[model samples]
Target: MALSTDHFSPSPDAAHLRARLSQAGLRATRQRLVILESLLTLPGHPTAEQVHRQVVRQEPSISLGTVYKALDSFVAAGLTRRVAAAEGTSRRYDADCTEHHHLFCTDTQEIIDYCDPQLDTLIREFFAAKGLQNFQPHSFSLHITGSKLANK
Candidate 1:
């Protein structure tokens, strides 16, 4: 599906990516492109290891370290967001640069995207009223725990 555009039509993902690379003044290397394309295609958030595995399928010569470097570049370029799962097992990369939250399932290790305007407004208001200083709140994702409790 083609995305609709407004007057302030932000560049398409590919164009934005090229522009980011140019702005960052980094050469558009194949490894970077492959790793980036993989990240863009992958849905939800993914661990560095997961991203490496996926990239390897397409570019066998790419290494895990290279994947990490590419991810760092993307984060630096503001093309992707890095989210640390509450479990701390692995960090997940989010390509969707939109306002949303996450619902994590302990049993299945699932991360679900959540969008609630009421919650967003409340959080913003709460933080604003507190007069937080020297704070750079880039994004917010609520990690709620859920699982079946056993009757001991």
Candidate 2:
């Protein structure tokens, strides 16, 4: 299917997304691509509702249930991940499935992605020295929660 979206240069192209979906054993549908686009473009870690709203702007006929289904399928396929939300708040989804940590803002509840090579090495070395008993380690990411201060 040919995708006619102007947000194709910096944003993920439909072809790449389709390939990813196929690799993850998912059939690449337009609805799913639009939903994934929202997940990747929306500020912070967006909830299912947020994605649904963004998707409807482009695809008016799409339903909330369909968005939820697409999100769950993406998570199961390792194409995206479900980030933990505080109690009472809705669950948030992140399109970046890379090995990176998150900086959560307690004041506004915004989630920010953080990557530190040194930290990754430190964590790996520490875990390598003191391994967990009866459990093998695959990856790790630190979620730090705090308010973001104004730029100096």
Candidate 3:
């Protein structure tokens, strides 16, 4: 099956993700690849159940448990990121493989990508100025809550 790299670039990072999976001694099974590829194709974040449903359409043999395991493996291998949804009821997976944030709609519980280099710089500067020695901020996701009707 062809892997979709539309949202995510098929650059060196792609190889790095694959390499990490390899280093973990993962055999890169077809099901695992399907899971990863699905994540890569989706523009918005998706829960494990959503992913499992999509995978089932292609490979009916794939189970929800298997999808969950593949998601764990991908997260462990740094191939994907599991993000908390608007309601914090379920986790969403992002395949962009970059440092970014999210904008969430409270009413619909929808999430949108939030990316800004200036924001990233400001965060680092703020931490540095405050001399935050205890907390080392690696990554951050800001869930901006707003009503969908307001947005419309």
- By TM-score, the best candidate is 2
Model 1, TM vs. native: 0.75
Per-residue CA lDDT of model 2 for 19-44, tens digit only, reads 88899999989998888878877766
Report backbone clashes per prediction: 0, 0, 0
Query: Residue pairs in steric clash, candidate 2?
Result: none
The candidate 2 region of ten consecutive residues with least summed lDDT is 1-10
Over 29-86, each residue of candidate 3 has an lDDT whose tens digit, in order, gives: 7787677766665557889988888788778999999999999888887778888888
lDDT of 1 by residue, 17-119 (tens): 5666677667678787777777766656788888899889989999999999888888887778888675778888877667777667687676666778888
The order by descending TM-score is 2, 3, 1
What is the number of residue pairs that collide in model 1? 0
Candidates sorted by lDDT, best first: 2, 3, 1
Model 1: lDDT equals 0.73
Worst 10 residues of 3 by lDDT: 1-10
TM-score of each: 0.75, 0.83, 0.78
Weakest 10 consecutive residues of candidate 1 by summed lDDT? 1-10
lDDT of each: 0.73, 0.81, 0.74
Candidate 3 yields a Cα-based lDDT of 0.74
